[model samples]
Target: MTYILQLVTAGLAVGSVYALIAIGIVLIYKCSGVVNFAQGAFVMMGAYLTFAASRLGLPPVLAVTLALVLMAGIGVLAERVVLRPMLKAPVVAVMMVTLGMLIMIRASCLAVWGPDPLAFPRIFPDGALELFGVFITYNYLTAGVLSILLSLGFLGFYRFTAVGLMQRCAADNPRAALAIGIHTSNQVSLAWAMSAGLAGVGGTLLATLNGLSLGLADIGLIAFPVIVLGGLTSLGGALVAGLLLGLLQSFTDGLLSPMIEDLLRAHTRIYSVGALQQVVPYALLVAVLLLRPQGIFGRKGSERL
Candidate 1:
């Protein structure tokens, strides 16, 4: 039970990070109708910016704040400069542009920061908490708590706030919302800003847990399964799905991998499973795609011809 609890705690922590990124993806899809594949780049941007600030002797909190602010600016600039111009382009073309942006951002990071991973400065205070015979590090506790809180707060803002209502209105029908006096374009831009800012915080949290690295952008791939599982347009679904995926990963690492590897080695001559936890998310993605196209939280809707 203690072991299970430990895994669950770890899973929720990782899942919270996934949820943050997934929410950002859903928000962009909702508001702009353009999937920002470069969302992960914003994650990297935040971590790198934080790392840079730390190098300059800034405190962790201020560094993280600065990074998020810069990430928001980058989001706004991407909307105004890259997406807005080609707003009328084919969906595939726009998606390709986002992919191009991702590649460009990565290349730029490599050029500026080089390829080695940096030892991230500690953000959370050093310590551990023991509960019910499970030991939890302060980093994990803080990251998990912060991630879940931020996700919940964003959901609250989306559900109860005026700006949230406006974002929803624009997402429902941009043209109609514009006709009704809402600034649909501004909503789209704001979506980008909020999404990027969320991703920035997520990135900082992840870096504190796993160290800062260019490879942090690759976590976006993990998020693909999360949003797909949650429903591309469902923010709430993303949160749930992120937690689900995180649990699957944690269990796979803790139990399934060892069991399968041992069985294979004893009976079938296979030596290893080669990181089974990493495979779990994609396997779940495939299952979700085949079984529930609308996703667990998505609803079927009608459209007028």
Candidate 2:
């Protein structure tokens, strides 16, 4: 029981960061109808930029803030320069462009930061909290709490703000939004900006946990399964799905892997069932795609034929 609690706690902490990044992806998809494949690049760039800022002697908080600002600017630039021109292009073309952005950003980071994982700058105070026999590190506690708060805060902003209403209008029907005097294009830009900012913060928090590396960009792969499971258009669904996936992966790593290994060793030549936890998300994705294509909170589209 104690071990289970420990795994749960650890899962929720990592899951909160996943929720943050996944929310950003959902935000862009909702507002612009563009699936951003460069999201992982934004995540990687955010961590690298924060590292750079810290190296220039900025305080940790300030470094994260600076990274967020730069990331938001980059988002807007990408929207205007890359996506806006392709607005009338085929969806496949736009997706390919985003893939190109991802490749370009990764190569740029390789050239500038090189191909080495840097030690992440310390953000949280080093310590651990013991409660109910479940040990939690300060890093995990702080990151989890902060990510949840930020996720809830962003949801609140989207639900209650005027700009958020405009964003929703733009997302629902750009022509209608334009007819109503909303600047749909500006709303799309804002979505990208906000999405990038969120990803940047998520990346910074993730770095504090996993160290800085180019591999951080691959988080987008995990996030894709999350968004698909949660409903691509539903931010709240993303939050819930991210946390659920987190907990599931944790349990698989902690419990199922050992159980499976033992079973396999007992009956067969296999002494291992490697990285089952990593496969869980994709399996879940396939299940959701087959069983609940509309997702938990997503509305099914209507054909107007």
Residue 225, model 1: lDDT of 90
Report model 2's TM-score to 2 decimal places: 0.97
Q: Residue pairs in steric clash, candidate 2?
A: none
Off by over 4 Å in 2: 302-305
lDDT of 2 by residue, 124-215 (tens): 99989999999999999998889999999999999899988898899889999999999999999999999999999998999999999999
Give residue 104's lDDT in candidate 2 (0 to 100). Answer: 98
RMSD, every candidate, angstroms = 2.1, 2.0
lDDT tens digits, residues 1-305, model 1?
99999999999999999999989989998888888899888888789989898889999989989988889889999999999999889999999999998999889989999999989998898989999999999999999999999999999999999999999999998888989899988999999999999999999999999998999998888998998888888999999999999999999999899999999999997899999999889988888777887778876541100
| Count of residue pairs whose backbone atoms collide, per candidate | 0, 0
Reference-based lDDT, each prediction = 0.90, 0.91
Clash count, predicted structure 1: 0
